[model samples]
Target chain A: MTVADVLLLALGAIAVGSGALVVTSTHLVRSGFYLVVSLGAIAGLYLVLGAELVAWVQVLVYVGAVVVLLLFAVMLTRAPIGPSADLDRPALPAAVIGAGVGLGLTALFVDAFRWTRFPSPDPGTAERLGEQIFGAWVLPFEVLSILLLSALVGAIVLSRPDIGARKAEDA
Target chain B: MPLWLDLLIRVAAVMAGFLVLPLVIGQAEHKVMAHMQGRVGPMYAGAFHGWAQLIADGVKFVQKEDITPRDADRTVFRLAPIVALFPYLVVILTIPLGPGLVAQSLDIGLFLVLAVLGIGVVAVLMSAWASANKYSLLGGVRGAAQLLAYELPLVLAAASVAMAAGTLSLPGIVEAWRPWWLIWQAPAAFIFFIAGLAEIRRPPFDMPIADSELVFGYMTEYTGLRFAFFLLAEYVGIVVIAALTTVLFLGGWHGPFEEQLGWLWTLLKIFALSFVIIWFRVSYPRLREDQLQRLCWLILVPLALAQLVLTAAVKSLL
Candidate 1:
């Protein structure tokens, strides 16, 4: 394998490891935090693929919004930040599942494609992405806006306390 | 230089830039403020100006204690800086300094840069939240609100430019503009630049990390070089956004003298834009958080919408 291939594989492995740790961790807060490593590395993989728009969207949506929201939820709920949570119980099963899935994915990737040397894209990826977004992906683009608007409204709704007083009056 | 060596040189150049530019900005800020107030801010740091201020600060930060709050989520707290500093490297990777001079000119450079730029916001949120201090938490909350509000207009403005330019690659965007898009669509350019400034968290719209209310906000508890790291990241961000602004709207490395001294023109434009950022810092007092929110929603958003319409109308007519 080429050096770049090796590097990508190593980084991908690291990403999967961290992501598994994120989900499998007992502490809800640390799990949210570990999601950053998982997501950022995946974005790095996206960068490697020449899909700059997809890569950035991965960062923008997952790192910037989703992970932050997860952390906020953890913090607000307090997630019982303490030593008493079940930290070790899930590790064994998760490790097994993770290893199996990792091997499976890597095998599939290696087996499926006739890999060739792809010349790296010349710069101005964002501009090209914008063009594609408007031209080919215009439907998804508009739908994404609608989705984001809904998410914003839902997040605002969910985050606020009921107060109970306003609910009764409205009812 | 060999290919590897050339790569090293570019990395070093960007690192040196990341390291030095903030110090220069600090000195310039001091000098400017001193001139305004009829007093010299720093006369003793070095020969011409207090040029060695960031250097001195860096050494001090390193020498100083790295404190972690006793109750903090130490892992995430530590992860925060890495997350914060990582984007700069990714952004600089795509940045074309001179003719054929970018470190790695990936085709998707603009997308990579903007994506990385968008990602940096999270570190601020994470830092503030993980600190567990009330002010830090509040700052993170404000940052989340501020980022979501402005991101759409920022993307829309950029997309409008991309529509006119007909490219997604940064270098392509530059090449597409035989005459700068700024002249054809000054209104779009204006909206994008202003929104980009807000996105970068420069005052007067820097509500997320408001200094007065939150006491340095997200990086409050971070001490020593870690705090220095955060500040360095901020200035680097200012440079990147300004560079993007120049590339997209200013016709990148396409000036009269640029053919001869390409880096010079790029830096001159970038440095000029940076001055405006610093100038805003000097002149205007920070906007109220709610006011910052309202300004984006009511003013800039409407302006961007109008620009999009104007652009579409002109394209159809032409």
Candidate 2:
């Protein structure tokens, strides 16, 4: 209907298509690359929805760090040159789960909004996002930081064989 | 002028800078490295101290045969060079040359720049995996590790500057920069510079492509024009790092007659920083990977965190 609507639809299609490819692709590395495309399209979707900060953060955190870590693990393990037959698994269960989730989400959103039109919100700049995080969402934000810190310490402990060895031996 | 024309001019300007500046830096590296080694670098290319050497190299690359290995993944291998090169071009677009001199300045320009620049790692990964070469894979993995490690400090240091300035926009940060910040933000600047060098895989941080060991790392399997693009991307990366350092840390466009001649000041700072980067390459041997990781995690990250605390304190006080 509108230019913004067109762009939104286009980006959504790209995101969904590439997301499907990410799961279905036989090549492990290619699947990772497809994930990049899917995440990037989601970033574009964020942009279309006027969440600039979230869009870039998506690119930075998801496409940049997370997927690279995924690819890194894949490369560290067996990354065959081409598609390996072993990557194939039973599709029926996965397809059922995927369809159910997709349909449930679609139904929930459709029921919630139900053809309502609302005024466009102001674009989410870094300042506004920061205020929201530190102001209203501060409690959950701090909890998330604590969770991340615990995970980090856990990782370090696991990685360092000597970290708890002496204490364990004494015990 | 219409909107399209204005956009066209900006795009054109960015493209010109993207094409020309890297060649200039490449030539400078050639001459600088040669002179530092007591040798004349390319005295015959453009007839005046080998000014055309990079141009000559470009021509040669263009004429060479592009090769994809038999074992390589065809699509990904071919796509790698473009992936390697595109982010620098995008990152350069948001960099402010002076007040109102940027191509397109977003409210979150600094964040966008960092985000786009981070994607360069994916290019390395793509190339490495697609090459199907042991050396390439090793190089890519090392590169990814190094980039990931340094990325924390890099973002932290930049975050300090953003906090100090109270703005996420490059131009606004420059406007906020005071002469005194040179001392106050010096530690963050140093950390940022070091982390940035590691990000671009420049020496002495260049373990990924340590020629003595890995044989050019992720780029081992690349040949001809594709290899040339990778080389160009490296030079362009140098330019991006230098420009960002100039903009973020060194008081961009803050020299004499800054209102009129600000772009010139920015360019001067960028070139000066680029020379230092080159000097670094010539001076230091490639770092051992363990030492590199240690320097990042043990040194730069903690220092950057301290700098952030200091910045917040200073900002609150001011």
Candidate 3:
């Protein structure tokens, strides 16, 4: 195998290994940290796949913002930092479901592709991605903005119960 | 020069730069802050304006006890400072000190810099969690909140610059403004500077490590060389942010007589920006966490979005 193949294997192993740790680790915060490692390895996979923009964006959004937010929520709620006895639940169901899904996806993917090699595509440069995003995907992009806007409003409403009470009294 | 030899020379230069630049900037910060506060700073360390103050500080840190609290997570606590400092070194590799001087001029250099720099938040959070102190945990939580609040605007502001330049490569962006720089993109530049300050957790946005209240916050339990690493990372961060601002807003290595003296111009601009950071520290009082969050979410984020839209419109029109 070439260097790229070796690197991909290493990164895939890291992603899968850390993903396992994320679920199995008893420490809640440590699980979140392990999630970072998993996500970061996925970003590395993207980098090796020659999607530089996507890779960095993955790092920026997933590892940087989402996981940070996850940790923040955990800390705010005073989640157990150490191993908690209650975290241990019967693992048989989860294991069976996980294995089934993993095997099903693998079989489906293998059947569909069947080791066919595709021609190398153009590098996904930022400029090209911007064009695709703003050109063909503009409608969905704008819709996503509205979705985020409504989510923001919903979050505010949920957080501040007094606002609803004030509106009810006015009505 | 051969490709490998060229790579070796650049790596060596970057390593040397990393070692020396932090000391110079740290001493500058001390002298400037002291002079601003009407006090002499470290007069005896070097005997010539305390030139050796950072060196003295480094020696002291090395000699001090490396303490780990009994309750601390040994592995994460030990690794945290390395995590904190490593990104600064990596980010430096992509920054263009002068034309043809960058260690690796990737097409996505700017994005890579921002992405790697974001790792600092993870490092800080890790350290705080590992310390197992209430203060450190609070500081880490504050850092997470601050990062979430400010990072959007920071990226948006930088996006506006990239939009105007029509490129994401640092050198390409620099060359785009050959005639004039993107400081003309004034609102975006201002947003970038402010968000960058928050990103680095400098004074006025330094709620994370609010020394007065949190007792150095996430760094409360750290000692010796580990503590020194955290401090060094902060100074290195200042220099990185300042250098980035110089490249993005001011012209990178662009001045009169620039061909021969491009690196000099770059240094001058970086140090000038560093002085502004130091000035902010000396002059502005720290903001409350709520106020900092409000400023970011309510004001800066929208302003940055508007700036991005404006840049897009202007770019298309031009």
Candidate 4:
């Protein structure tokens, strides 16, 4: 195998392995942090696959902002930070489910393709992605903006303390 | 050299250089501060101003029992420092130091640098939370929020420069300068450099890791060499950010009659900028979190966008 193949495989392994840790880690805050790692590693794999802009947005939005907010929410709520919560519950079934999905996805991808084909584009990839995003995919881009606005409003609502004590009093 | 060979050498040099630079610069900063304050700095440690300090630090870190607190989450705790230092290493790769001095001058140099540097946020958050420390966790959350507020203006300010210069390629942008881009985009570029300092969590904007508030924030639980690594990363980070500013706003390697000086001109320019960064750290009092956020979003963002328009209009007129 080429060194590129080895490095890419290693990165993939790190993403999947640590992603499981993100779910299983007993400390709720740390779990959110690991989610950033999983997302970032996925971004890195995107880079290796030559999707530089997507990799950056993954770092920017997912790792940089979403996980930060997750940690913020985790901080506000008093989750058990210690061995007070049990860590090991039912990993055997989780392992089975995880492996089955992986195999199923692999089968689907393998079955769908007769031969692999990819378009070669010059770098300055952010600009290239910009052209595609604003040109052919402009409708989806506009829709994505709406989705982002909704998510932002939802987050602000959930974070609002005024809504909480007032609603409790109303109840 | 072949590309593979070149890559290997550059990687080794960066890794080895990063390992040692902190101790050297730490000593230098100490000595300079001491001179400024009228005192002798470390007169000992290998018969001088602590020349072997980083080596001793490295040895201590290697020997220290890697600790995961009883209450701490194991997986994330182990991974945080690695993630923190990795991107710091990755950023120095895109410097485009000179004709032969860069590893790979990827076209999206500035954005890639910003993205890599931004990912360091995750490492800080993980380290803080995984430690299971109250202070560290608070620090992490504050830092995250602070990052969001500052990052928008930082990018906008950078975009203003990119608009004025009309290229995202670091080397190409540098070559476009007739005088200096700094002279042309003085208003925007100055804002960009100052905002860059805040982006890196330097003093005056270091709300998340404030020593007085969070007691070293995410680093509260760390001790000895592991903490040393964090400190090293901070200093190296200062250099990296400064180098980026040098490349983007300043005329990178360009200078008056610099042909004879060769690589010396670029090094000098970058080092001069680095000294200014150090000067700011020594001079400024830290800003509060809200103040930092307001300055970036409410002020700098508008300022940069306006400058971007002004620049484009001027280009069209001239």
Ranked by lDDT, the better of candidates 2 and 4 is 2
By DockQ, who's the top model here? 2
TM for candidate 4 is 0.82
lDDT of 2 by residue, B91-206 (tens): 99999998899998989999999999899999999999999999999999999999888999999999999999999999999999999999999999999999999999999988
Model 1: lDDT of residue B130: 72
lDDT score, candidate 3, position A88? 69
Per-residue CA lDDT of candidate 3, range B1-318, in tens?
Answer: 899998899899888888888888899989999999999888889789888999999999999999999988787889899999999999888888788778889898989988988888998899988898999999999998898788888888888888888899999888886444454578878888899899889998899999999998899999999999999999888889998888888888898887888889999999999899999999999999889988988999899988888888877888
Best-matching candidate per TM-score: 2
- List lDDT for all candidates, in order: 0.76, 0.94, 0.89, 0.74
Instruction: Compose the digit string of candidate 4's lDDT tens values, residues A58-169.
Output: 8877877777777767676764565436665767987899889999999999989858787655652877888888999999999999999999998887899887768889
> Model 4, B280: alpha-carbon shift in Å?
2.3
lDDT over C-alpha atoms for residue A159 of model 1: 74
Consecutive 10-residue window with the lowest summed lDDT within model 1 chain B:
B106-115
| Collision count for each candidate, in order | 15, 0, 0, 0
DockQ of each: 0.39, 0.87, 0.68, 0.47
In the range B59-111, model 1's lDDT, one tens digit per residue, is 88999999988877787677788788878867877878777767777665665
| Residue-level lDDT tens digits of model 4 in B1-318 | 998897799888777656655455566666665676688766766776666655665787878776668878777677777777878788887775554456667777777777778877777777877788988888877776777666776677777777666677677667765664556688777777777777667787787789998898988887666676677777777767777777777767676665555356666766676677766777788988778778877788888878888888877887
Q: lDDT tens digits, residues A61-157, model 1?
A: 7887778777766655564443436555656777789789989998998888758667777642555766788999999999999999999888876
